[model samples]
Target: MLKREVETAYDDPPAAETVNPQGASPYMLLCEHASNYIPTRYSGLGLDAKELQRHIAWDIGVAPIARELSRRLDAPLVLSGYSRLLIDCNRPTGVASSIPEISETTAIPGNQTLSHEERAYREAAFYWPFQREVGRILDQRQAKGTPTIVFGVHSFTPVFKGFVRPWHAGILFRKAERLGHALVDALQEPGLTVAANEPYQIRDESDYTVPVHGEARGLDAVLIEIRQDLIGDRDGQMAWVERLVPALQTVAAGALARA
Candidate 1:
């Protein structure tokens, strides 16, 4: 029998949801902060429902966008099923953000004290499964001689720490500068700003997906962040979808071809 979590989260749904695993597109998408669902046992990590709904708990509105991108691009997508507060799927375990005590302006009451067992349990229950699946899929693709580039879809609050972010979208990369700048250029439009590595930067200490899953294997990778306000509703999501698909298509072809 598997080593059960001291506190079981759910029975039916698995930790990671994989869509279109055999998708033909060279791009692979990830939405690590996809859900804001903290198990009832955690009591929303000692937060009320309203606070749980904030960006501190999740990426706000990029999950559906990623799913749609998967369908439109015929690209495989992996989504984490739990809130980042429960355990951040994109953060390396044992880091402060792995189970952040304070997310932005609000302090997470439940995370203030944690036993090693609890931390380990959360990682085992929530984090590793998603990571393993990502690794497995990439391994399979590599064996099949497929050219795969990774994109992490995320959304950030338009105003963070009281300062308004000017860029409409950010393409963050560590080693894939060529592809990153190309994507920024692709998404640029009149009265629209697409930035390269603005708002947030990808560092091994701060992130896992692009650094571990993408750069580690020498794959071209980027984390795409859209201002949360832009993708808050169906119309907004579709608009971004329309804007992103073509740019990704154009950039991925050239990025992979050059590699």
Candidate 2:
């Protein structure tokens, strides 16, 4: 293997960046598909500029919202800096989607064949630093006996496989029912659409953020997914943020009380 076949440096932008690491709120946020940046060595993963901009590359318009939420909610947020094509921060290590060869319908040529060292390099450089930061934050909260509600912010394309999704947003949870249901109900207003566990669900086998950092520690964890089309621009991102900030603030007390 050539010396440049795999990741060897931190690059210009690190694999992950954290905001408000010492935030006071119990709400800890994670944006796994926050960026679509592919290191120069990957060479766009054999993709054109257009495909790299697609949802398969990253969760469109989520990083900004998560950043704002970290501010408005006074919560600490962990954002992965690289593209999901390199390795998905939210996914468990070695899963199919973690380093997807085919995301949605588009094939990732650079990911087609990877060696043990290459895979290991990506995990060390792209994955662990993010997950460990999350774990460290959670551990601090646990030791301090501080209340915590783990939330992962994500986005999905409005259409997949020729089917259109109806809900504008979905709150996914496995054990944090009280907090998750409260959010789903709150987002349900006169004209808005919200559901429980739509788009995706949390599975220990596939998911890492909530399952390991939240649930494993007995903390209430939930995954909040918004429609990518709804948050594709600045205005759309703010609207959803205005909607979610209040909902999260409202249910937080009850969730923490239960915990």
Candidate 3:
């Protein structure tokens, strides 16, 4: 059974509906899997401690990098507060992976056989509102004739099953070829293997970043995937941000110059 309650240890900063007081910057950062927090409401969907620790539950090392990147760039960030186990912010709300009945090979007692109403509640409560906030930010920027660059940050496990992912970072995108290419080129560091859409590809199936935000608005966008092991600690996360921030600024500045 799923129980909803409050977790004092995990306090949500504010509702997604609330805009950042500093206003939006030309660069907008998004971290879909920021927190592995399960609202006391669902008691973590019966996941074990280890499962919560897995990359499937959250993007390890991504939250800190996203936060640091936002601070360093003075950009407003939109992040999901719940664990992907409850409802994946990256996947479309209607997809099975969005609210997984089974994740990391463990069956979730609460997510199993979720009724239409229950699914809708989660979608409306968590998914839609979060997305609406992004849309609001974009609309405001557009109205002001300020072009914006959308960057989604994510982290993947170094080893999945028996296979090891070798790249330090990867980029995912569909038609924003110029923007994507520039970013990869700028991030070319010694011994750093940068994959251009290697591990994951941006397609129609990609909901949050490519669909509703990028393609929908015809904005220059890219999704960056960092190796989890490289960014699991504070030192590692900062190092990545230091490397990525400059590349991003260069790409954004180049794009704006063309426009």
Candidate 4:
């Protein structure tokens, strides 16, 4: 099984040039829950067709939107290829929440109890590389004397349990940065309620991106979450790309200006 050929289970190395290169400045964008692919290696983890489609597997619409946004903004994007069920790429390998057995009401069969070796295998194969790559990108950019502002892009399900998340978009940040706050202000859509880390808060125990890349390095970073329904389709994705480009561009510019 170690050498198994599963397309969705493994992540291909990023291209020599970043997939999406945006702006002349050093700001980078990332979408950790960007893909739903299961790397055919796991055979859907003994799940039914419907089970694989749940939010437990991936954050719907995030990959494509992130790709489009990267292309539109010319920003480098480090996206994960495996489903979160295999092992959440954004989480630390030792964290229980890294590979959740129960996500909302859905049960992930492949994630049931197993040997310590099994856990370590998933961590080594999928989780570490994804994170290390992000770290490497940041390091290289910083070494060039470029200020890095990491943007974490993710999408959430519209209806969870019974209650609905009302905000169209929301921003999560542990430390206040001038650029992040300005982005929230610029993204004030008429019907959209932009939450400043509502629904969830950023803490060291659970968050991987902020602690590892942002807070640890003292670089400006903001975790941006968009409701999945909005970007679930091609048209909606384009609309979001357009809506967010100027604001992100302005925010990127603001980061440069601050330095």
Candidate 5:
């Protein structure tokens, strides 16, 4: 591949937003699919406004929950500011899904048959910066001898491909299986359904954040996926935040004890 550097200028919002950067908590929250904003330059990726608002553009309600959880837990949170349709922050760069031509059933007209310059521009403009910011924070914490656990917050559609999903929430992990299982067990309740790695699983080709930033550094990490229908509103988001803050705290404590 020829190396081409594109000079990216931001007219919309920033590529990433970090909150509570000074927080002392061991947990670091990441919302990779936080926003559904396509830069005006992209012209909504050749889709209507309605399509951009759909779950394909972003995780439906993960951003608010992540913010509230960060506030409640006093952990630093990092959020990507562009639509996943532009370039999925959680997916590996140069992959098919990184800049998906088709998300779900909707075809992205703007993403079709791009030149190398276009692909590199999107990665340079929107993708790499977000990943670099997360890495910088992790580096700072590691340098300070602070123990850190990476938590990726996401939400899934209640129904996917005409099949109804019964999981209220899911915890996804690969190498950090122990932490993933602990969180899955911690989230169990009398009637609430929590599954271990459902809807989607993390892989090198399909994911970037957990594998590159968390597992590569040998830090405990997990991705939490809530059903979108459950967290589509403020009340639901707050409720999940309340439920998750404690569960995450308990799990972190247990991990520390074992460490």
Candidate 6:
């Protein structure tokens, strides 16, 4: 049994925002969990402000880093405007985690028992729009013969479910192994512990952007996850931008040379 689908007007910000849309760089940055806003129509999805602010609602500090990456790299970036709680742009539509009833240990009351129509509404309003935008960008680039690298920027909590993660950052990929490993090697600073894939892994069922827009199109793509604690402020975010921009440039150049 399922609850009657909540039929609310689709309002709030647009599903996606593009920055430096015409930038010349070969990289296209994505920040899927960029916001925590659940729209007033959903009434905060039955959670208080504190819960909405948690890492479960969104990636804590990846937006600034993504914006900086877009600025420094002169690359186009696409960022989701709504919370992952409404609909995760990074996740495939049919996955349980796509509209998580329980994110981490916190139960999402609004998502507990959604009807198919409710899920479809969210997909239509939030999920599909973002996916379409990304697809359009990639398609345009392909038509122009412009080489593009898709990079998803995200942040993970230093500790999750009472477990501590040691990596300062992680580079995740499935099909773009060479570029992924190259980024891993490049990000290995003296004081930083960079992992090839830790905290989470990329899967077609679990993820959308890389698989659909990047791998499907045969473009190099990888998701970069920085520890949330490290990028919680401007100074921290800038430090990572400084570290990542060059590494990405170096790798992008190498990838082009190899192509």
The candidate that wins on TM-score is: 1
Q: lDDT per model, in order?
A: 0.90, 0.87, 0.78, 0.75, 0.90, 0.90
Per-residue error (Å), model 1, residue 250: 0.6
Error of 4 at 55 (Å): 1.6
List RMSD in Å for every model shown. Answer: 1.4, 2.3, 3.3, 3.1, 2.1, 2.9
lDDT value, residue 219 of candidate 6: 91
Candidate 1 residue-wise lDDT, 1-259, digit = tens = 2366545644635789999999989998999999988777777788998998889999988998999999999999999989999899999999998899999988999998899878888888889999999998899999999999989999988898899899889999989999999999999999998889988999999999999999999998899999999999999999999999999999988977787
Tens digit per residue, CA lDDT, model 5, 1-259: 3243333344677889999987888899999999999867678989999988899999998999999988989999999999999999999888889999999888999999998888887888788889999999999999998989999999999888899999999999998888899999999998899999897898888988789889999898899999999999999999998889899999999988898
Ranking by TM-score: 1, 5, 6, 2, 3, 4
Residue-level error in angstroms, candidate 4, position 222: 0.8
Question: Candidate 3: deviation at residue 42, Å?
Answer: 1.3
- List, residue by residue over 1-259, the lDDT tens digit for candidate 6: 2233334445667888999988889999999999998878788888999999889999988999999889999999999999999999999998999999999999999998998788988898788888888888888888999999999999999888999999999999999999999999999879899998787898988988889888889998899999999989899999999999899999999999998
Candidate 4 C-alpha error for residue 139, in Å: 1.0
Order of candidates by lDDT, top first? 1, 5, 6, 2, 3, 4
User: Residue 32 lDDT in model 1?
Assistant: 97
lDDT of 2 by residue, 1-259 (tens): 3354343554557777989988999898999899999878789999999999999999999999999999999899999988999999988888898899998888899999898778888888788888888888888888888888899999998999888998888999998887889989878888788989997778988888878888889988899889998898999999999998888888997666665
Listed per model in order, the count of residue pairs whose N, CA or C atoms clash below 3 Å is: 0, 0, 4, 7, 0, 0
Q: lDDT of candidate 6 vs native?
A: 0.90
lDDT of 5: 0.90
TM-score each candidate: 0.97, 0.95, 0.90, 0.89, 0.96, 0.95
Off by over 4 Å in 1: 6-12
